[model samples]
Target: MSPKKLFARSAAMIALTTASFSTFAEEVNIYSFRQAFLIEPIMEKFTEQTGIKVNILFANKGLIERVKREGELSPADVVLTTDISRLVSLTSQDLTQPIQSEKLNSNIPSQYRDPENQWFALTTRVRNIYSSSERIGPVDITYQDLAKPEFKGKICTRSGKHPYNVSLVASVIAHEGEANAKVWLESVKANLARKPQGNDRAQVKAVKDGLCDYALGNNYYLGKMLADPKQVSWAEAVNINFPNQNTTGSHVNVSGVVLTKYAPNKANAIKLIEFLSDDVAQQMYAEVNYEYPVKVSVQPSKLVASWGQFKADTLPLAEIAKQHQAAVKLLDEVKFDL
Candidate 1:
C-alpha cells in the first residue's frame, strides 16, 4: 500500500479503537516514523500501568508532512522518529512544543536532547566500522583513516544521502570543518569498493561475502544479525570496531520523540513521554530493538553489553545537525555516490 493509504487506514483504525473505549479513558495519539513492532510492547506496558489508551499511526515517512498539513487540528500528541535529522526537522518546522519535565531532564543527558527540550532522545547507537574478521581481523581505525591511500578500493557503504551516512558526513564536517571534510569525502569516494549502495546491514553482508575489507554500519546491526538465524554468519565474519577511540571517539546518533504543538492530550502525552524515558521503557528499547538506552541507569541487553564500551565523540548532536546541509553539499561536490 502507498504510505498515504496505509497512514490513513492506520489512523482510522486508531480512531475506531479510541472511540470504542470509555469516554473517560485518557488517550494520546502518536504519529511515528518508527516501526510499530519495536515500540508496541513498551506501549502495552504503559497502557497496563496507566490505563491511557495509546493510538499510533506508523509510517516510514511523511509523518512530519502529515502533521504539518493537519496543523492546529492535528490529533497527534507526539511524534516518534529515528535519527537526529528527523528530530531536528520537527523543531525546525515548528511542529513541536517545548517540554518541561524534571523526569525527562534527569533521565536524558544534555548532549542527547534539544537544548530547548523540544525533543528528547530515547536511544543512541554508534556509527561503527565493521572489519572483515577473515581479512583484516581486529583493528583500531578512525573516520579519517577511511580516506587514506592504504584503504583505497577497500571499503563499502550505503548511499551518501542515507540518513545514517549523512549524519556521519555531518559529524566529519562538525569535527574537521567543511574544507577538510570535503577533501576527506573526496578521498573516501575514491576508496569505495563499489558506488555506495544498500543499507548498513547490506554493507556488512558485502564484507562477509569478501566484496570489501570494511563496512560502515550502526552498532546495533551486529546484535540484530547475531540474533537472526540466517545472518549469523555475516555477524560472525566481522569485528565491530569503534572508530576514533584514540581521538574524538566514535560518532553516535539517536532515536527521539517530540510533543506536537497542538496536542489534544498534553498531560497524558507528557506522562507517556516521561514513561518512555524511565527505566522500564528504556530497558525495553535496549532488549527489544538492540539499541542503547539513553537513560543512564538502564544497561544494554546482555548481547549488546558484550561489545565492550568505547568513547563516543563528545560533539553535541546539535552541532552535527548544524552541518547537515554542508555535508550534503560536500557529498554532491565529491559525487560520492555516483
Candidate 2:
C-alpha cells in the first residue's frame, strides 16, 4: 500500500480507538434496589453537572445473587439498597470493596456508614408509630410501649421478618440484649391487632378502617401515602409519632450505596456515591422521598419537617447489623408472623 493510504488507515484506527475509550470512561453502571422513579432525577442531575453518563439496572430483589454470579466479570459499578441488612449482606458476601473518600467521610456521619468504608448511607427513615387521629390523638410512645398489655389487639404492623422490622428488632437487641429483646418480641407479637400482614401502608389503611388503633411504619411511607390520591385518606387518618424520644430514641434505618468489588468504572462509581452524599442529591432525597438526609447540614423537606423532629437513636449501624441474625431468630422463636 502507498504511504498516504497507510497514513489514512492509521488515522481511522486512532479515531475509532479514542471514541471507544471516551465512551468507556464517561459512563458508570449501577445495580439499584431503589425504584427508578425515586432516584432517577438525582442521577440525571449528577450526569448534567459532571458530564458523566449514568446507567442503572433497578430491581426489588436478587441483585446480590446476580452480582455474585457475575463475579469479577460483573458490569456493576455501584449497588444502591435500603436497610442495613442488605448493606451487611453485600459486605459479608464479599461483593463490595472498601473506599476511602474524604468527601464521603466528611459528608456522612460515622454512625451511618460502615467503619471500614464498604458502605455509606445516603438517606434515613424512622421506624415510626402511627396513631389514630380520632382515637389516640398525638401521644409520646416507645418501642417498649407497644408490648404493654393495654396495647394488646390495638397495634398493627408488617411481617416481623421484613428488613425494616428486622432492623428495628436488631436495634432492640442491641439496646436491651438478646434475652430481653426476645421477650419484647413475644409481647409485641401478642399485642398484634391481627397476624402481621401487608406493607407499612396497609397497616395504616387498617387503622383508617378502625381495624386497629395504631400501626408501625417507616416515616417516608407517610409522605408516599399522602401523595398518592387513593392512599391519602389512610395517611390523613393517622398522625406519625417518632417513638422513644425520651429513651433510646427512634430506630432509624437507611437507604445506602456500596462500591462493587470489581467495579468496571471505579472512579465514576465513587463520584456517583459522593454526589449522592452531597447537598444536591441529599436535598432531592428529602424532597422527593421524604427521607432524612444523611448529610448533617441538609434539612428534611418542609412536609417531613412538619411531622415534628425527635431524637434518632445514636447507635452505630454496625451494631444493628451485628444483631440482625439474632433479631430474625427471635422473630421465629416467637412465631412473630404467625
TM-score of model number 1: 0.93
List candidate 2 stretches off by more than 4 Å. Answer: 1-23
Q: For candidate 2, what is the lDDT?
A: 0.91
Error of 1 at 183 (Å): 0.4
> 158-200, model 1: which lDDT tens digit per residue?
9999999999999999888899999999999999999888898
TM-score of each: 0.93, 0.93
The per-model lDDT (C-alpha) reads 0.90, 0.91
Which candidate tops lDDT? Answer: 2
Predicted structure 1: clash tally: 0
What does candidate 2's lDDT look like per residue over 233-299, in tens digits? 9999999999999998999999999999978789998999999999999999999999999999999
TM-score of 2: 0.93
Listed per candidate, the RMSD to the true structure in angstroms reads 4.6, 6.5
For candidate 2, the per-residue lDDT at 17 reads 22
